[model samples]
Each structure stands twice: as structure tokens, then as C-alpha cells.
Target chain A: MAGSNPGCGTTRTFKYQVRDQFGQVMLVYNMQLWDSIVTTSTNTCNLGGYNTTCAITNTGPCNVGTFADGTFNENLGICAPAGHLVSGGCITGCTTTADQTWNINGISLSGDVKNLSYQCDRSW
Target chain B: MYTLLLATLLLQPIWALPPPPSEQGLQVKLRANLENYTVAAETFPQALTKVAAQFEIPMGIEWIRTSATQREIRRSWRHTTVYGVVESLVKSQSGYDFAIANGVIHVFPKGALMDRSSFLNHRINKFEAKNEFAGVLSYRLRELLKRTISPPLPSSPALGTAGSIATGAGDRRITFRLVNASVRQILDKLSLATDFRIWIVTYPEDRTLTETGFRRVASLYTSSSVADNEQPVWAFLRWGDALPK
Candidate 1:
């Protein structure tokens, strides 16, 4: 969503989160200005039995609770309007064009696997 | 001596004592406390209505009707008789008058109402117009003068034709192009184009006056300055006040 202008010589930030079924904190996605250049948020998840299940917390200031039923897709990094599909942020394919790079450590046989970080792109 | 005193007392009449004021004679009484009422600038009629309402006179209806109902009147009152305030309001306007009928004061046009004999005795004020078909503007001018213009009872709208005057004294086309014109100006324009004379009106057996020429004749008028901020200036045609010949 295109948030309103904070006015001349000001800034604004939108905060997001991922929690479990019982509102347990699992991830924090904060989109903010990079010193005055770009706006992006980075987070990781596990999918395909990758030892991760995350849910989006669209609460006010960012309250989209109407579609925050906990279901999310791994590849698209999106959620269904009414179901609870849990997946991780890590992908098997490697791409050099990634903007963010991080490490994902899970309970599977995966070691400290280096992976490209991602953020949900919502532009209005 | 006791018998004589009793006869004297009984002979005195109760009517000798003067009666108190009746309800009609009593001054206006406010239903609310408005001694400190100071409002923003408003028209004369609006102010009069506000002041009258202090004495519980109803507002928000066409209580006042006249051609010269002043739009702006600035005055105040404190502990004055209601009719006195009303008289002051009447003085604030021109070509306007008021009357008390059945104990309720009404502000109306100068010649708004008249009896059958009086109606025929009075003459419609002299009016002059130079632009447009004075005939059409006459009715529109009358509409502007009324507090509540009584439009002809609704009927299916239709256009009846009248031929040229030279051909057989037929109908003529009157034009109107006024911009913020006053009631007097409108009446003037109507007088010039139409024969300033208002004919006694008549209706055909067909229930429409489209054809004209049955019997009765009367004139009406109204005026006010209550148009809101965007008092429109009509300018469809170049029909302006005709210059002197």
C-alpha cells in the first residue's frame, strides 16, 4: 500500500511480522529507508518439510487481518485469503540477481546454507 | 339603616371596574431565553425570523413574502414588545409592508391581497421593459416576488403556437438574458416588451390558458435576495436592457 507522505523532510516505516498459530513470534519483517535510498524488508522461511511454518501479521497501521489466515506459498512468498499454508523462505534454485543474501539454519540435514534473502513486494 | 346599606352595595355594578388586557392585546412572549442572542451577519428577513422565533414564532417556512425583502439587516433588540420589533423590521425594507391577521403578523407584498371591489379599483403599478418578449418575463417577474410562488397546477407540458402580429396579430417571441438583475429591473424589462397592462386571466374549457382570451385579469409579484453564494448571472442571449431610442 502507498502510505501517505510523512510531509516535507520526513520518513515513514512499515513493520511486518510472522507468528505461529498461537501468536508466537517467529519472524520480523521491517521495511525501512536505507539511509535515504531504497525501501525493502528481508526475512527467511522453511518449506517442503524444511522445518518452518510462518504467518503474516497484518495488524494496524498495517491491519489487513481480513486476509491474514496464516496460509503462505514458499516460491511466491504469498498467502491464501482463508487457509493456513506454512513454508520457509529458502529456495533450492540459486540466482545471482538477488538483492539480499543471508544464511538459513534449520533442523533438516541442511548445514549453514547460504541463501538469497527476500521481501514481499507490495506496491500501490 | 342596615337594609339601606345592603341596597346600596347591591346596586353597584361589577362592569364599573375596567377589564384587564386580553390575550390578543398582550405583547409577544418568548418561549426561550434569547436576551444574549448575537448571531452572524444575516439578511433582514433571516434576522426578523430569528428575532420572532425568540417569542416562539415558527421559522423555516415561507412566513414572510415581499419583493423588497432586504437580504441583509443588522439590528438588535432587548426586552422590546414583539410587534414593536416587527414594525422596526418593516421599516428596514422598501416596497414592503406587514399586516396582522387573526393575531399573527404577516409580512407580504404591498398589493398582495385585495377584495373583489378593491382589486378592480387599484391599478397595476406602471412598469417598463425594453429587452426580450415582455410577455414571458412578466410571469417570471411575478414568480420572483412571492414567498411561495404558486405555480400553475401541474399539467402535461405542451407548447401552443401563436402567429406573427403583422400576419394576424399572432404570438411574439420574447427573449431574456439577465445577470443578477433585480425584481424592479425585471419588471421594467417586462413592461417595455409586453403591453405593461396585465389582462384579467381566463381559462379555456380545455383547462389550459394556452389559447388566451376568456375573462379574468390579475397581476402578481415577489422579490427577495436569498440567493445563495453563487447567485447565477443568466447570459444565454445578448438580450440586454435596450438603449434609449
Candidate 2:
């Protein structure tokens, strides 16, 4: 009787630390009500046409739920379990998409040059 | 009487004045001309290190670990000073920049240099070290930052996960004292005082992370020539590719 009746699964929040190549902590994110069965897919293409040129598709289990911060996309599946680390792709170059001015240590630096953006690993 | 004194001072030979501060040595070295310099293909740090060694000048290089860093850098400079070569190399790269401070060449990312939230700008009340090994001193500085920062940096077991600190009778030692100095200044002082001249700090390039968070995972690189037991903290590799034991 005990084996026949399964109780409701417990819900818990999971925390993931995104680290860099040097094992430095880049950022931290939390996921709530993680559904192990959920999966997500993404399609990326180069400058060429999607069908005629280079195209890549990635499909993985959707481990990430809502991000505490609004900066990242909601459907990001990069965060994995404690032992299951994810590899974010390398930044292509020094060019950044952040357009803002910064006044650092009494010196004002303003330009389109801003924070470097990471190109996520589509290989996953 | 005052006019006479002023005239006498003006008449004194310029050589009587003290030589420029030691910090100007870096400028002099940078301006020294080179007939030719060439590199087939190497990382920016590798190219810069080769040049720095040729000039026998100390340098500190900081950057983000990216495909760009591993990208082959091939350049040849003819009839140029060290300054020209450095300027050209950094300008050719998108996110890199350099600053000469405290008699050390510091190559770093433009964003890390300009980001107001960088831990480099954190102020320390007092920092004093006597006859300290270069690697140990560097570790202490990081510890100081972790302990003193107001909001406090995130605690991680990885912080203790660095290459083994080299120790021996033959190890180089340094001594310095500073009051009210920024972490950047401390690093410059350390570079100037140690044989581990080539310092590199690598940052993560995640746009979603807060600027301050970059410091948490930044890796420090220094000269590999110290001793057989001594080695640089980490080699250039992708994140999570390998974990240190």
C-alpha cells in the first residue's frame, strides 16, 4: 500500500553560481520550482541566411525558471545542478553592446565602449 | 635681498636638482626606440611579455578570458619605441587598454579600468608588509579586500583555490607601507617590488552580472619564472573546463 501511493513532490529553490574560466564567480542566479522534465530549444544563425547559410539549433532540458534579476532571458537553460556545470561561450572580442558613460575615480570615460557581453554556448 | 636670493637660485646649475622620481623610469623605457619587433602568432599577453622581457621592464596585464584573448596576435613594428608598439597592439584589439603607473605597465580591459564599481578602486586604510614573498603578499591583498569592503564580497571556497604558494630560502621578498591607498595602487606597488612582474587579472564577460561581481571570480596571473615550485595561478582556459584539486 505504501509503495502504491506516492506523495506530492516537494518544491524547492535552487541556486547556481556562474563562474569564469579561472573559476571566479561571475554571477549567481536562483531558480524556483525547477521542473526536471521541462526542455527548451534555441535556434541561432550567422549573418547568412538561416536555411542557405550557417544555422545551429540547441535543445536542452529547461532547468532555469524565473531569474531574480531582469537582465537575463527567462528561458535560459544554462544553470545546471551542483555537479552539472554549464559552459558559457567565450566573448568573441572586446567590443561590447553596453552604451553608457562612466565616471571612474574622478575620470570621466564616455563612449559606446562599455561592458563586454558574453556569447552563450550554443553547443550545449 | 629676496631678489638676490631668487637670482642666485636661478643661476644654479640644473644638474643640482634631484633626478626625476623613480616612477619616470617607466616613461623613459617606454620611449626607448626599437629598430624592429615582430611576433608571428601569440596571445596579447604573450606578445606583450616577449616585448617586456626584451626591454627588461616589469608589466601587469589584466584581461577577460575570452576567445579573443586566445586569438592569435601577429604584428610587426619597425623603427618604433616601446610606447608605439604597445599603443598599436592595444588599439588593434577591441576591449583592451594600458596604463603606466608606479613604474609598471598595466594592460587591462577598458571596461574594468573605467567601471566605477571595480574592486580596484576600493580604498584601504592602511597596508603594511615587511619582507613578504610576492605571492603571499598578493594573497594578503585579496584577503584585505575581502575583509574590508563595506558591503563585503561574496564568500566562496574557490577563493582559497589557488596554485600552491611558493616558499623557500631562495624566494624573493618585498617590503612596503601605504596609508589610504587604493587596491590598484597596492597592486602596482607589488608589481614594482617583485620579480613576478608580469601580472594578469582575467575577468568574466557576462553582461547580466553586476560590475562588482566580476571581482569575485577574477583570476590573477604573474610571472612563471620565480622557481620550480612556483607557478602562475591559472592558465588561459574556458570556465569550468578544469577544476584545481
Candidate 3:
């Protein structure tokens, strides 16, 4: 399911576990700077699940939380506002290119493990 | 006869008592220096309103109004009417704050002191704008004393007098010349590098007769020492940057 595209009129579920170190979960819905949206939920848990039905309203270049509950199941479809191109890009930690980089507060992490080595990207 | 002598002895020197300052005394003293202040009054504008708004404590003349009643009229024709003016002064731990409580009318300081004084003195003295607004410096100093010392009301009471005239006619053209020439001259003296807007507010009504009861009329705004120009001018400038908000 790493690169699967879930079509319209369908719901997809991804099971995730949040580690104890970072107590917050953040899902980056889109990657465009001007049209970006990030949703944050909080709790300490190693296991959690989120099911998102994708349409023309919630397309994303997505990134999950850093630690516990950081895993996400992404359903992909054509979701773009007017004057925007529907697009998809993979993101992990805080890096745009590296799938395992964890960036927070403008500092980037180095280790592959969740919450270990991640970048701190606090620029808003 | 002994009782009468005793009463007289006990009543001695009441005549030597010092009298309190009278309202008539205040008015007489003020009028003697009336040549100094440019007295005018009208509905206050919003610039003054903003200054008054800053103060939780009121300062200067705030609420002013007039009323006529049947009972007052019955006593005397003048008694029927009254003009009530209220002023407030505030002392903040930071500094002094003053505001008038009037709903819309109040005293807000304009940054340009000398220019305001110049125009005001010209009004009071009825002079042809010799740039003598600085004359108000002495008058303002005098008012400081009045604010500190004078009693609130006068025994004689103030008799209000007002008149106005307008002109765009006749060979004299005195009104037009005075207004236009004075404004132009002042503007010319301002810093050339900077631009300024000028406005005139006349009392009673903007369209009132050329002669009117002016409590005061002044320039609404001004800046200091236009660029490099340094001339010893003082008036509104005396308050400096501590101008009322």
C-alpha cells in the first residue's frame, strides 16, 4: 500500500502506532506552501488508525506524525482547488525528498527509527 | 449698657477678615489679558475626541451644553439659559493625562504649536498675520496660573458677545485677502521638501457671519523644524512630542 491510489467513492484505512517519545500526531494533507493544511491530534499510543475518503477536497503530499500514531493510510484521488493541479508526493519525517527524515523546529533528524534522528523545521 | 459694650468687644475685627477671591475679580483679570488669548468656541471635532478618549480620567473642558427652562426664564430672561462646560484632569503614575469629557468636543493637542498660536493671536489681536502667534506663549503661561488658582465660578457672571461678517464683494476685499494671504504666507514658510494640508474651522457654523463668537480656531496639524529650517518659534511646539494622544 506504499504507492497505492485509492479511487473516488471509496474509503481506505491505515493502521498506525504512535511511540511514547513524541506525544502528538500531525498529518500534512497537502504540500503546496500556499494551499497546505496540517491536522494535529494528540495522545500517547503505539497503535491508532485513521480512515480518510479522498475526493477533490483532500488531496495530499502527506506526512504522518513523528512518533506514536505517526503511521497513516492515505487514499489518493484527484483533489485540487481551482487554479491548482492535482498532485501526489511522498513525505516522511520533515524531509521533502528523504522518506525517513524527521524534521522539527528547523532541526533535521538522522536515524531511521521513529523519533530518533529528525529535522526540526519550524518555519511557517 | 455693660452688656452692649461686651457684645461690641466680642465682635471686634470681623471686618478685617480676608475676602475670598470673587468671580468678578477673575473675569476682570482675564479680560485685562484677553488681548492675549484667542477665545473661540464651537462644536469640537474628532481629533479632539480621540485625545479625550485616551483618558479614563477626563481633563480640560468636556461636556458643554445650554438649556432654557420656564422657571429659569421666569426668574430672568437670561436665567432661562445656561451653558455648562465640564473639564477633567488626570494624574497617571506614568505622567499627567488630561481630557475633556464632552461627547464630541474636546481639546487635542496639535503638534504644531507656534503655527497654531500665530493664527490664534492674529485672531485675538485682529492683526494682519505678522506671524505673532508666539504672543500666545505669555497667555498660555497666564492660563496655567488661572487653572491652578482661580475659583470655579464668578459673581458677576460672564456676558457673552458674538458677531461675524463675510465678504466676496466690494473694493475692500479685506476678508478674502486676510484669509487667503495668511494661509499662503504660512504655507510658504513651511518646509518645502514636505507637503502639508491646511484647513480652517470657524465657530457657531462654518457659514456664520464674518464676525462670530470664536472661543478658538486653530490649525489641526503641524510638524516640527521643517527639515533644516531653524527659527525660534514656540507655541503649540512647547508641548513637544508629549502631545495628548
Candidate 4:
């Protein structure tokens, strides 16, 4: 995975994997970023869609009856149960959504692209 | 005197162009037989289909066979072919046929008053790129026609595929028949020579039929062949994903 950074106007591969306490690897996600630097000029990178290759691991002893599932928002950010949080920020953005749009493999991300206030809801 | 010699050199007869190879005479001899080709004994229908479509001409496949052997002994096949062209009433026509024996293809052309001949030659090569391998073949079969025949008239109809038949055993063995026009078209389009074949082996279970998996296998074929000093004589394409640990 240690390769040259994708060119400014080109695409690059961005991947993520989820692991449980016992180091058992779970789900893995992969994406292709059309451009690494996402600013007003270059604002989009394809977020890899869901992966069926890896399973979700819920192997924690402190788990309640309900499973603690984690979800990733390519546009908004990463979300976990109230008590649990994705430490490293698996999801990037929420910094600025003004004139910026996000897509994964050519599909636009579902949800609100703007906030009721004039301010852009650019955090995730 | 030097100027005179130079002028003489420039005056050399253009008609002195060497005659076609002896093997390519008026009647191109498509070796009496043909041969079948394979990669480690397995036939890759997808690659065959794709390449066949790419290399062959429009209708040139009429001269080949879909399946030449019976079920029992399947090793023998024909890989090369030959053709000849003749003139008829104000119009020009060509006859084409093939003979297979021992993994080679020999094409022969036939027709009324057919008085022309030509030869074609082919060769295959492989290369490496990024995480994959690539394969290509150099072809010159037209010479084969010219050498076997004396004078060749204009070629007739282009070549393409007749059809294909596929049968596989579980997940291990697969067989395919790419005959006639289809075969000729692929070789022609790719300019594939006879020196080697290209194989694209897949990973069996890859659900994604996209070009990524197929292209990777093709690249591997070239890279491996180059390292072994052997050109990509054949290709094997498969698709599969790794099992969970």
C-alpha cells in the first residue's frame, strides 16, 4: 500500500479494514480517489462501497444484547454507538462541503448535501 | 566513374523484386493436416473467443473447423491455415481452407483457374507491467501463402468466426472449439505470429467479470513467459477470491 501519492489530477486507491479486540480482521473497504487533494478545485474522491468479502466482528465482552454496529458515511463521517467511537476517523470530511460533492464508484452519497442555515454542513 | 556507378545503381530494374518463397507457389499447400493448441492441456474459451473476435477478418473463418476430434483422444488439432485466389468472369474470387496437425495451422486456398499464391507468418511475445503481464505475437502468415504459390491474385472475402462450443468438467477442465473464420480473424487483428500463444488464467471464483481480473491474468502470462525465456505460448483465465482466515 506504500506507493507514490496519486497525481494531483489523477486517481488513487484508498482502503480501510475493521478489526476486533482479538485482532481478528473483519470488514474491509476499498475506494478510488480521483484526486487526493479535495478542495473547491478538486472536490471529489470515490468512496469504496460495501464489501461482502469480510464479516463484521462483534467480539467485545462489554457488548449489550444489541450488537454494536459501525457505519461509515463517505460524506458526513464515521458513526458508532453513543458509547463507542471509531478512534482514527475512518470517515474523512465535514471540514467543508461548500461547492464540494462526494461520490463512491460514480454513485452520489445519499443524504442532505446542505444545512438549513446558510452554512454548509461540511463535517463528517 | 563513381557518378556513372551511382547512376547504374539507380537504374537497377524494379521488376527484380525477389519472387515469393518456393513453398508459396501458385497453389499454396495448406499442409495436408492441422493441429490443435492448448495451455497445459486446457482450452480457454473466453480468451479464445475474445482474441478470435479481435484477430479474424469479417468472413475468413469459413475454412476452419469448430471441433476436429472425437471425445476419446482429444490431443490432435490444427492451428494454421492457407488460402488461394483466382479470377472469374470480370470478378475476382478466392478459396480458403485449413489443415491441422501437431499444434500448427496451415491454410490453403482453392478456386477455379486459381493462379495466385501467398504466404503468412506469425510469432508471439510477452512483457511485464505494474502488477501484471502482457503478451503479443508478431505475425507473417501471408508469406506462407506466397511461398507455397507462384502468383497470387487479390484476396477474396475477409474471415470471421463460424461458431464456438463449450464443455467443462466441474471446476477443473474446460474445452472450447473456435473454428474457421473466427480463428483467422483473431490472428489477423492481433497480427499474432505462430511462435507462441497467449493464455489468460483466471482465479475461478471472481464474481466480477470486469476486465481487471482478466487483464491481470493476461499480464501474469507475459511476465512468467519472459522470465522462462518462453513466449506466452498459451493463456489460462480464471477468477476467484481468497477465503476468510
What are the lDDT figures for the candidates, one per model? 0.26, 0.41, 0.20, 0.20
Give stretches of model 3 more than 4 Å off: A1-124, B1-181, B187-207, B212-235, B238-245
lDDT of 1 by residue, A1-124 (tens): 1222211111111222233335564332221101001112321211111101111011011101111322111111222111112132212221111221111121121221213222222221
Model 4 chain A TM-score equals 0.19
Give the range where candidate 2 chain B is weakest over 10 consecutive residues by summed lDDT.
B1-10
Name the TM-score of candidate 4: 0.18
Winner on TM-score between 2 and 4 is 2
Better of 2 and 3 by TM-score: 2
> Candidate 4 at A102: error in angstroms?
35
Model 4 score (lDDT): 0.20
DockQ of 3: 0.00
Candidate 3 chain B lDDT trough over 10 residues, lowest sum: B162-171
TM-score on alpha carbons, each prediction: 0.24, 0.49, 0.13, 0.18
Q: Encode model 2's per-residue lDDT on A1-124: one tens digit a residue.
A: 0011011111111122223335454333322111111111221111111000000011111121212321111111111212222233222211112221222112233321223121222232
- Let me know the DockQ for model 4: 0.01
- Which model scores highest in lDDT? 2
Give the per-residue lDDT digits (tens) of candidate 2, residues B96-198: 8888777777777787666655667667899887655544466456545544332224462211111112121112356679999877777767655544455
- Writing each residue's lDDT as its tens digit, candidate 1 over B72-147 gives 5666767555666666676666644765432234454355334222111223333333332332233234323321
Off by over 4 Å in 2: A1-124, B1-21, B148-165, B168-171, B207-214, B220-245
- Model 4 residue runs over 4 Å out of place are A5-124, B1-29, B32-70, B74-133, B136-195, B198-245
